[model samples]
Target chain A: MSKQVFIPRDSLNQALERLSSKMNVWVPAASGSNKCGSEFVPYRPDLIPLLNRQTTTPPKAVVFPQVETLLSYEYTKDPDNPSRVKIQLDDTSAGSPTLIFGARPCDARGFLLFDQVFTRGPFTDKYYRDRRENSYFATLVCLEWDSACFCSSVGSGPTDMEGSDLRVTPLKDGYLVEALNERAEPILSLMEGDVPTDAQQQDARKLQEEASRQRVGNVDLTRSATDFKGRFEDKAYWRAMVSQCLSCGVCTFVCPTCYCFSITDEMQGLKGERLRSWDSCMFFQYTLEASGHNPRPTRFERYRNRVGHKFSFIPEKYNGMIGCCGCGRCIRSCPVSIDIRRVVENLKENACVCA
Target chain B: MEASATTRLHQEVEASIGRLSTVLGWGAGYDPLHMTPLFVRSPEDIARLVWNPLCVQNLTGYLVKSPGVQPPEEGKKIGICVRGCDSRSLVALIQEKLISRENLYIIGIPCRGTVDIRRLMNESGLSNIRSVRIEKDLLIVDDANGAHNLPLERFLARRCLRCRHPNPVIHDVLLDEPVTPRTTAEDAYRDVESLEAQSLDQRRAFWSVELDRCLRCYACRNACPLCICQNRCIAETRDPRWLTQRVNLPEKFLYHFIHALHLAGRCTECGECERVCPMEIPVTLIKEKLNQITRDLLHYEAGLDPEAVPPLLTFNPAEAGI
Candidate 1:
């Protein structure tokens, strides 16, 4: 039987501290006093996690960081041969046991897509694999959602527990926690709380049921890919849809499923490091070939590719599972207010006419 | 007065819709508190246009963006709405000959101050807003919970706090009477001055902390009207690569420096770079410092005079001292 426990409101910090002691823990916290938004930060005793709201920046950095050093190298003159140089390589992995507390279901679901790309492929990324094997998620059953949230439309919901190791539902005075998998068993044992009463379990169940029924967005995007491909050649449609698009990477940066990255070697004299960082298809350089030919030249082609990659291309490759998790960060963070749902829905309307 | 301004704007746009291939204006977004750029092709779409404090975007950047609003086949013009700051961007573009003045029909609106949605939400603690309206110097926000009345200054954008040009510099059709500027030129550089007062180490520490959070989304670059090298930006070029793919502090600092230096004499103080930043970094301050240098050394201000060339773009052979 799965273990169930209740961590009272006052004891929440204590529970987090205990969890941190056992493993590296991360929680959604405000970036700073001057900044208006929050992001996933390493847990500290004084840091109060913003559990009620979605983080402005997703927790993808925990696994796929914005910048990570793949390896470092140094060159030195060899004593045996003056003409030849000796090379020293730094190739140590930094993965450790980690616990991500209070992640929303949408944030946790992002890892499922990452797993498909990094873990299930022939060329598995050792860095991503190491982090994936060591981390655990204690996702909160999300009841709070904004207009930007459309988790329900893309086959996910506020209360979906597809990838959570443990499920937590806030109650009147405490949070009811249920261990969903074996990874959460040790943490559950360390938690100093009483087993949740039968009545409390019923309350959590009711909250989950209501949250699942709530509709976040109105659009049904099951066949979004097919519709997008049908209108691929319609330049007028693309122009009208994304005319105000700043051609910036805000949408992709805030998106939970976007995993495009670029690698480069940074050197200063005899020392150098190979680094990998997040990249966006919205950028003009994303498709710039070494020979100076770019297939996706303008923002029109780039925007179309972004929509296609998520809804059409990924689904075709990944057994009809759409790449977008529908967390609504793209819509919320867009400087021009370009709604993806509206764009995808419009795709179906203009396809037949254009063809 | 505001109601008449809105009416006048609508009538002017409606009148020009037939002669113009497209009319660029603001429309209601997902919510009433937000406004998105509206592309009005026909007279029917003109009804969608609205003018209010929520119209914060500097729409002039669209004039230079690729695959932009095309001109009609039979010598028709393109109509665009410009606020005080936006008109300056248009002026800068026109001065650079990026767009022809004859092809554009400018409908200029006198702006009191545009609302910063982040600041408004923080001040009022209001979200899920149903509607928002500006009455005199007060912002009234209504949500499902209740209504909130906030002082306009408390929720004004950082750019509006020191706005020196509330009235457009040039316009084909003026939408309303000129509005008084919110601040004087003297009070414009207080934020920059305060930063200058700090020690070099303190300033370095401050910037390091701020720029460390940048996701390198490039929203700041894309929103800027002066940054014309859109697809061929030096930051992304490989042959003479100025910046690496590394997201370190040094790379971030250098990238920002390149951006600032490129806009040294050309920036129109539109505040689009700072406004569009997701991390809310005060990016405009960098450009402001450069503008201050140009103002002091060359006695020049950008986007003010269409005939005057940018200080750096043209050289004065007789200029001595160097």
Candidate 2:
């Protein structure tokens, strides 16, 4: 049996505090003034984690931040040889061990897709790899799902423990914590909790079984990628599905698996830093060329590319792992309430018609 | 009474459906509590149209956005449904000559106020909503748990709370009786006054904390009908780049400053920027402060008069004296 501990409801904060002392800890907590809504914030002793509700902002930023400085450089004139200049460069490779507490399975699975692009590739992104190497995820088994949630549709379930270092399942009084990997064993040992009895362990197993069996979304997207390619040239279909898209980056910004980024050099008088920030395919500038020619100039084409990237391209390249984790933040946060499930499912029906 | 108003709105659109090549309006979303912008190409599509406080989107931006269904003829007009604030956006578009008034058949609706979804969820402590109903000043929300009754004032969008215009200033056809304005001109700047009263450092600290949470998604800029520089926004421009892609507090602050400065004299107080912000940042407050300055300095209010030019857009050589 995996090393298991039972933390009572009141001791949850104390446990988080203990974890924070060893390493940086992030937990889902209320953001701004919205008590019902949550975002992943750095855990403090005073902060209360909202484990029952899904965070509005995904925990992807914990691994891949919205903005990161790769390196900083300064150029100075050489007194010995005025013709040549001396360059000083500062490499930013320093990273501390991080524990992302209260991340849902869907949020944890997002990193699995990101791993294919960043760490598992021939040319690995060292910056991302450094963060990935140092981070550990304590993912909660999701039981509460709203209309917008559809994690199961994209091959991830509420109880899916694919990328989790620690599996946390909520109990009536507290939580049942199980260490999944070697990295989590130290943290599990530090937790001030009683070893869970066989009854508690059985209860957790039952809950996980029930959660795994539940279907949150109504679409069967097994052949979604093949269907998406068939409708690539169908502008009328794309227009019908995504006409209300505001071309805003809300969908991409809130998405867990969207890893598209743009790198730029920022310079102040003599010193400068190269920065990488999140970029969205939905933006017109994402495809804007040097010659002022944009292949995806309109919302229709841009929306199509977004759907295709998640459903077709990524799955083809990464061996059938759909880019979308289907946490449904995009559906919930979208100004126009455009449903991606309906769009992707429509593509499948169109393929059937053609077949 | 609200039901009757919705019925009357349907009747008016049904009557005008034949003459209109396309009618832009709000329709039922995935849930009843929400509404999505709908494009009505035929009379059959009119049934999807809905009118309620939940219809929060300012549909004026669609006039500039290319539509899938085009007009039958080159000069044939497109129909649009506008609320009090949305009408101002339409007038501003006409004033700038970006869209001609002749090419639009405006269907105006006097709005009481739109509910902020975030506020409603917070106030009611309820999600997974089955349905929502507005009666007088109370909002009734039904979910799987039970029914919740919340006061309208507690849940109204921040912009709607201080709305000075509840009736459309200009429209081809008025669908309902004019609704009374929720707030007066004197009360409009209360929040702005409070923010201004703070010491410089206190004010700086206030914004620094709030703006630090911004993801720099640019949803606020994209949702604004007046922000016409869709693709070439200075925030994203590379040549002579005004701002870097850094997600730091200073860069975020500068991006908002650029957004506010660009709309110094032109913002119509539509509140779409604040509404669409996923971070719940009070972005419209910055625009309101700018508007307050313009009101005091130049005695100008934007989107009120179609014939009048924006004060910043035009200069008076004789009145250069402060």
Candidate 3:
């Protein structure tokens, strides 16, 4: 058996506390006092982290928060020439080194899409780039697959190690933590655990094997882009699929892979700050042009774009990296439970033909 | 097996689909614990219709919201399924003239409290569940690992616990025998009262933490049946500039208060706002507090009598104890 570091469940918080002195340690914590809602939060002494199940909100906020100030600006007028305004800007929102302690593999995989848009592009967003580069993910090998999780269907799995700096596997009494690369090596010592016994290592291996073997769904989305293209003009098909959708931003807000945002200047008199907040394609204002015409006027067209962007357009544009991570937050958090998997599958098979 | 109550309801909807444009109901989701709002257009679609404790969604919003089921022709009407709480929303819509009574065919189900799936899952440690069914007072959950029977009373939603109207106040057709209400009108605001009994600072602290967690997804506003200002909502409109895009605690507090105050006396306590909240914030509690104030000051309850206008909507100078 390979030797590995094991952090006992009891002392896991102590190790995390020790790590926090070095950098911000984010863990999957209950949103309030209830376990029903979970999000990645900066670790505190009293906070009991949730490592058992998938969090309600992803760790995307670590790199790209829902709403953040891009820059603060102020306007000043000279006494002699009041008409001439001087603009002073402050871009002080620098990112600190962060360690997301209990991110799932699907959560880690979502950053790859962000990297494609923010880092690999010609005009890089400095705020996102700094956070993306400084953040390291200790992804947990997900053993608890609910109906909402479809990581395997989207080319990611419970143990899929893409974009993960460290691998954390839960054992009965502790977690077997291992650094996948050199950058992650230092954090292992910060976990402050003893080397795993042969028996403990064997047990973790068995769990790893079990997690890798599990399958969530059998649907093949290999021909999704082409199929979606074929049915792009079928308005009736799209209408039937998402008729129950409430057109709320829950799906996109909870999604780890949805990286769309809108920038606006929030001003209080002469003092102003540019803010970047999360935006959803489901809303009417998303496609509203300056000419007062909206291309995606209704929920039907907007929802169609949502499906097309993830399965068809993103893959075609980004060299075959589908925008969806299939973390299943879109399905789980949808007020009406409009399954994206079902919609994508139906894109290939026209609803008219079946009904 | 005998035809269940849900199956019988589906049979009735199948027969009525010939005279209706579409029937709004609940269908099976990816799992048994969750239910999706189903829109049935044809006879074949009626089979998807379900009526059970898991059918927790309040479907009245679809009448006024997106892809609404209006009359296809002048003569034909639209069909809708409503629980006791949902029927109240339906009544409120009719009272406001958002939907006319003549254009609807209502299918009412007297609800005996729906399960709080999140709470049930949390307390029971049930995940990836296979099936959930009601057997009298117990809820049987099949999670592949084992079958666990949980008491139904322990998992009821907080709104359902305080429900004073378990039977539909307005319905063209009643599906089941009406059940007795769990609480009286005088004690219906017990939960809100407990929160009120706390010191003002304590309540403020509680809401400060709860509202701070808001992602500003606007799910609560979207799910509410009384919020008819869909695209023109002030919360999203930058032209008027009531609030900024900043998601700080102050912005969240303003947004929630605006949502609750907009419903003042119109909110029927359907609990859809609380149900749809992804963060599990008890947003409906805010609206209920408004309803309590309206109740005491005006001696009124919304949606019980469609003919009576909400006191807040109209100016009555002669209103007692003003």
Candidate 4:
């Protein structure tokens, strides 16, 4: 437990402004072209965070960028031996401390799964480790849940603060802010807030208590590793479920915990860069072989791999830690509204039957 | 629509579906303001079919894209539901011979406009919505709070505001009496005109800011009915090497160019690309500008006549030798 304080709603921007001067701060801001959507951007003096709604894209990029340069290289002709050429390598990793404000609890929880892959690896990924160790999360105690949200079903909830460094609970006209870790304590002073009154403290507790009990999604998604494994070979089942899928990358791109990537070498003259970019198993090219043989040749097979990788493969590999945090961005942003909750829940039972 | 109208539509559609390979239509989604495309092969699923301003997706892509509607068996037809804008895609597909006209049973619905759920949520601050329906010129939304009435025209999609084809150009079964179009053809390119009014630098800045937010999820391309390349799209191909995997502004700009330019003379302006974009980047404006140029320079309109070839694709033998 840490100290608690209250920052009025109007002063929230001032607190973020001050935090930005100390370290990199990301706040959810409305897109220039559309007011209905938002993305995380660096905080400026006049920037106001969209506290009411979730961002279209998560702050996952702050720790692991969408596209990252692993290393840069240049080839030069050797002076002493003309037949041999010299290769110069430059390390591209430059770690910096960052703070992500206004992240939903589900959004913050995504990092835990990422940590499992990047930090506890057979060989620790230096690029991911550098950013992961230096970043802090100031997650909001989520008060809203819609049809797509299912954090509670995934062993987490709206008020689940397992991965957050700071927990911010919304109040009537202000916020009740609490530091959950020593690294986040310094930010409370930066908020320039007053001590919460007894009434305000009660309000904060009631909100979290109510949220904790709420059923965001009416399904149990945990313990699905066996169910998924049992049905992996049921080709008829998989085909029926994914017949309507467009095989677009929307679901993977919007997912907070989906971290699959492909590395490519981009060359220009004498210099070249080794880059890593996000990849989706839904696409046909994701598993295309050099000889033009594709292991997952059809869209249904690709989609099955995606579902398996999240629920079954990760648990089999990582001691039962689920790959999904269930922020539901994938569901909400999907053009066809393919509900993943329905798919995962129905994993325990037969969803569709055909001849 | 009136309750009787909905009933009549369902009954008629249900009666005609016995011989179709599949009947493509809209079904209830996770929420009131969302709808999903449904392929109805049985009478039980017909009850799930719905029609409203919330029906936003253009389902014509299923006719041509793989894993979509498969080719009908000999002498069988593929049933589809199309609004005013979707009908144009059918004509374009027929014009290019992508889908035979004789093999379709189109149930056409006259459209006023489809609601933009994002715009409605942003403007009304509405959340936890339980129900939404249209009554005359107003949209009635019900949430945890009581019902709130809003003017429908102001909340219509940006593309809908300038719609010049509210009546399906071609149809086998017309659902309703045709409604008046929102704008005349002269005012059709108003969105492009405003963008053109800006200086060159201003235009560049506008696009730079918008494209910088693209995730390259390819939702817009997949949603487009005329983007027929599918798995062979140039944006994803290594053989052509047109683009890298970089998520920077230059790569994003080029990808948008590939999407817009490929449909330069063929875009039906259904607004699916703009609607499906999670970033809400107003991508349709890029295609609209090209459409304006095609209309002015080539003196042509696409998806209007099934037999007419697009100006860009029309062959000139004397110039082709070069």
Candidate 5:
């Protein structure tokens, strides 16, 4: 663990302004189109007020955009042989290193989760990896917790900065800076020396721990994940449970761990780019075949998959640990207020009946 | 035994439709050899119900298209007949809340693999084949060569060969004695796996050679049960045209990739996409890869049950190994 230092609360604006000169700094900005604020924009120190609140959009857009042009190509007549076909590169401009400010702890943890799923796989996504490497992350430790916040149960919480390069904790005068990765070293090196004493580290730790305890954030999901597979055949129960669900994918769109995407080619004139955008299984067409057959045509099966994957299948495939990070985003965002917490609680209590 | 099994299955369907008609006042019918939708209004019409090798149509696809049945005002239930695979789809639909369990009176059949008519046609190179008859486990194909005997298992639909669960996972009423669930591991995608095992260059070569045969007919896309976004697929859309109007290798590659990616985790190993491909493209190869991905990444199978959540919407933070 790196030592933390305090910067005067008033000097934050100046610090942001200094950082903006080097590279285009991206802070959460209001997206007028969606009437939602939180999309990253080029540095504007005036937007520091938005940093305290958690971003509406996850920081993922900063790295892996909703739609990206991986490579563009165009067809033109060859100079030497007009009859011969030739494919030429259209553009090769890549995004520069961006500094993302005020990312929440959950969003930071989301990056770590994405790292494992995307980086460890057989196919290395160069675009995502490159953007990830170039981007500098600085997260603000959460002082407040919501009912939707359950990161503590899955071993990560509001204060956990497992994936951040730099972590900032609010202090009386300003902010306490802690560098967690090599990338953060440069930023810390630039700061005036005011190293956090041993007492300060203890204080921060105690504060974070007490906050976690006071909020009662951790809900025991151990039994649910361990024993969920056996209960898969409980058709009557699961079917009844999800009978009220609407197959809208809002929960997925808001979720940080949902990496499933669909690829589409966009052609402009003779040039085209194949882009991958987020896709959800909740849609009717997600599993429906043109032959007019859909295997998962029911809401119960989709809901069961949601629970089974998080608790059983994911743990079985990755390790004994459950797949859910206990980030209760799904419970909060579901249109019908379908509480995953209650489901998990029921599963945990009923685990004794399972093998 | 096969004939009796089908007849018994037909009888069960009639009984359920009868029960549903009395209470809910709705009914079902069976299409003949072709995939034309069925409409049954009476008990006598149920005699036309045939569960032969030619029943390649996914009956679940026709359920949403009711025969003049309105919402709650019209009736309380919608009666239909479903095979084992069809029942899984129904379960998925019910679990997803697309169709209420209360609304459906399903007569579930335990399927002993359906025959692949396309594969049979290809083997004999017969264009004018008349009809298909199943005698026990033997498939009798009446073509230019009169009648030829083919082992049922040999020409069985790929989905049915490795079918471990041959009974409707969810059903209100079941028909015919459930056949002993077979653990027969049919190497359905062994060829795709072998091809994938090759180096990237070799794999590229193989795909190029195979795709070279594509005529860009879009038959495979038309045949897929999961491909319902035909009205607005990005490839053919005018608003933001995805590919060139001219048919070429690159355009075909894009179309295929989009199709495969669309079905990734959701594909239930149904071979309808490949069956309808006029160029005989093994479109299931893409679905197989996606199945492998879903199994490996999330350990979840699609369309196995109605209550299982689709993989894309479901996430486990713990699975991230945080």
Candidate 6:
């Protein structure tokens, strides 16, 4: 945690206007894609944009959105208390502390794969832990890598802080930063300038370890989570390997790590609210049933429950760690191109023909 | 790879429902083996019409189960029938003006494959087959293990081994004599194009070894007749129950990411969620990689033209040239 730079770009816009006077900063900049020049914007600290590569959508939509309004009722009838139910909680946005900045090391390792499903163990999501504890995050160090980048196979790269607190790098005119959380050492000791020598932190750690060995190398994932909990009944090899699935739903909305959701109730007659979008067990209406039963009722049991919920149930509930963050974005958004690395090399050649 | 076009499209749909039931007195017997929806009103019950391969239902789900799609006291207009994916769902319900191709008569036919009679009574042990018949390239199937025969592309049903339009592309009549078209395999999506020859830890070890047996149950969205919202679903709503009916594995990875993103760009590859999955789940290779991403990034083709449209209700915000 020792590297400071800055060299007057308004001292990084006065440390993003002193973290935007205590809340909401975002940054990134230039939102206008169509091939060529500037795209990833979120801005306000005088329109950020120093350099970016990802963001057609993801910064987990400023904390998971694409459609949000969890509650909103209003069926009034209170002639001196005749019946009451109001129901509100909708227009949110008050909780602030954001910051964000550059975000790149594969979107800061997709917030360590969304803090292992929104903050560890059994349910802890007060709206994604109150906007991820009033945000901050940081990260940048990519310098290059696309054709739908892979997060260097799985260990992550383009910088990898496992979810960043403060990272940066760039430098011929401005950045270096570094920190990596202890709530980023009082914003890197209220960072205001110099402290980058040792040949510019060994030339930004040898160009971030040669841009993480030219973008994505070690992808061995050598079979562990108890070797797929000992081959879960190989249904004739995932039914002759998912018969060219056309189940749509573009690889879980460009997954950084997919998190499914769906619940709607939009009301009008007695005022309504219940809403919770984002569902896709590869759709036949996400496991439909109400007496009509549908146990994964096929697309190959919904592509084998999307490859057994990312390698045997998110590693039997987060211990084996593999709900997919390799980030090839569902193999560059499959459309009959269907290739989850060839269904994991045909489940490692059907686990070497079941040993 | 050839023969069998279901006995010449059921003798050109029983002679075009016997000339639309002798000049519209109401085409013969409308018996879908009497599972209801009758009204052939009578023309000698058109010799109790029949079309083997037990007509695998979807006669537009019996034309919205009859009543008033036109049959209201009319002396005999409703004859119906159909095929090419049930007349492209009656041309997407007459281009969504919801049914009115002149009060109705249709017939159509031209299909070739059908029999999955529950995989032919689980591969011809033939339980109580009784009468099955098809003839030209065999099928037969009589009872207590007698008749037999077989050969129909073995059993058919991979959407009739890649059916190139079979016949009723729209239909109003044209029942018999079509059948000669058979050459499919346009590389039958080469197993979703050999999944770009794997390596991202073998596609995350092939979807975590098949979503470790998801049990969230919804019969692939109720035998999906275009999952037309069966009584409002977001996987069984309950205030903000955003999916936690707890079948496990982050709710079966949030129920296959909200059932493959609500069939993005409207999935119409129709394996009926891999023929109603009871944990058989090949969910059509995620709707055949979302029908090859709406036909290579939005050329769009779901339910082929009932006036087409729906590639995500029109969006080309400069074609995500964003």
Models 1 onward score TM values of: 0.94, 0.95, 0.97, 0.95, 0.50, 0.29
DockQ of each: 0.53, 0.50, 0.70, 0.57, 0.01, 0.01
Per model, state how many residue pairs clash. 0, 0, 0, 0, 48, 72
Candidate 6: true contacts recovered, fraction: 0.00
Candidate 1, residue B212: lDDT: 85
Cα lDDT tens digits for candidate 4, A1-355: 3388898898888877778888899988887644678888999987778877778888888888989999999999888988899999997686787899889988898888898988898888999999988888888989877768888788898898988988999889988999998988887777777889999999999998998888777787877888887788887677556666777888998888989898888888989999999898877789788899998987778888888888888888888878888888988998888777766666775554421
Instruction: Name the top TM-score candidate.
Output: 3
Q: Write the per-residue lDDT of candidate 2 for residues A169-248, one digit (tens) a residue.
A: 99888899999988788889877778898888899999999998998787766567878888899877887778788899
lDDT of 1: 0.85
CAPRI-style grade of the A/B interface in model 1: medium
lDDT per residue (tens digit) for residues B1-322 in model 3? 0137697788779778888988889888878888898888878888777888878888999899866665556678889998899999998999899898998889988888988888888788887688788887788889867899998999999889999898899998888889999999889888799999999999999899889988889999988999989988889888898989989999999999999999999999999899889999889989989998988888889998889888887887777945
Stretches of candidate 3 above 4 Å error?
A: A1-4, A350-355, B1-3
Interface RMSD after interface superposition, model 3: 1.7
lDDT of predicted model 3 = 0.86
Each prediction's Cα lDDT score?
0.85, 0.86, 0.86, 0.85, 0.61, 0.57
For candidate 4, give the lDDT: 0.85
> By DockQ, who's the top model here?
3
Better of 1 and 4 by TM-score: 4
**How does residue A169 of candidate 3 score in lDDT?**
92
lDDT of 4 by residue, B1-322 (tens): 5355557669878878777777888877778888888787777778878877788889999889887777887877988989899999999999989999999999998988988888888889787888887787788989988899988887899888989998899899998899999898889988888988999999999989888889999999988999999889999888877889899999999999989999998998998899889888889998888888888777778788888888778766554322
- CAPRI rating of model 5: incorrect
Q: At residue A138, give the lDDT of candidate 4.
A: 87
Considering the two chains of model 2, state its CAPRI-style docking category: medium
The DockQ for candidate 6, computed on C-alphas, is 0.01
Better of 3 and 6 by TM-score: 3
Residue range A1-355, candidate 6, lDDT tens digits:
4435553455787766765676666766543221122224445655656464454335665666544566676666677876765544554544466767777766556555567786785886566667777777777787654333456655566777776788887867677777776777666665556777777788778877777666453344424345444444676565444443445555665565667777666666777666565677876567677666778765667777887787668767767666665655454334323456445545664343210
